[model samples]
Target: MPSTSDQTLENQNDEELNSLHGKIKALRSVTIDILDDSNRQNDQLDRTGNTFTQFTNSLFSTSRHHSRSMAASSTVRQYRTIAYIVGAVVLLWLVLKLWSFGGTRSVPPDGVNGEYRI
Candidate 1:
């Protein structure tokens, strides 16, 4: 019952609708892929957070253990600390003396004999 012109218009509209349907399907597929990727990233982040938490707990435990051990007899005694300080001072003085000696070129005075310079 439709005229030729109406039939042509109806066919064009049907073709446009099919094209739009195809585009919607593509968009849905892309959205689903994005959702899957987001979920994967979230899971990875959660695992990393758990790993960090475990590491923090381990660090705290080690720190507490170290403090406890240091409180026991492993700490440096007073005489040992004093000896160490004295040894360090002597080492520093020796190093400075050596440095000063290295910087000076030993030359005999104009009239002084080389044998007398030692």
Candidate 2:
């Protein structure tokens, strides 16, 4: 009877050791899965950051081009206004000179109030 009881105790110890080993294996698998998920999340964040940087750079470039174009257009407008002012001044001077002539005729070269005609 004592031998039989010793054998039963040994069997229970073996069963408990196997159960503990299986539980340890399950914990290890769970830890590995968590690490994989973390790595994946970090990679996704890096991609998103890169994409945002590219978008911002493109937007900045477009705005710079537009600003330069607007500055050139403003310069052209200023030149056009100056040209118009000069043309108007010239026209006014011509009109004034013509009015002074007053449809008058030129005197003949052959002596009008002269003692001798050259």
- Give candidate 2's whole-model lDDT: 0.87
Per-residue alpha-carbon lDDT of candidate 2 for residues 52-116, written as tens digits (9 for 90 to 100): 99999999999898678667787787678679999999999999989888865565455556443
lDDT of all predictions: 0.88, 0.87
What's the number of clashes in each of the models? Answer: 0, 0
Candidate 1 structure quality by residue, lDDT tens digits, 2-49: 999999999999999999999999999999999999999999999999
RMSD values for the candidates in order, in angstroms, are 16.1, 33.8
Residue 15 lDDT (model 1)? 100
TM-score of each: 0.63, 0.55
C-alpha RMSD of candidate 1: 16.1
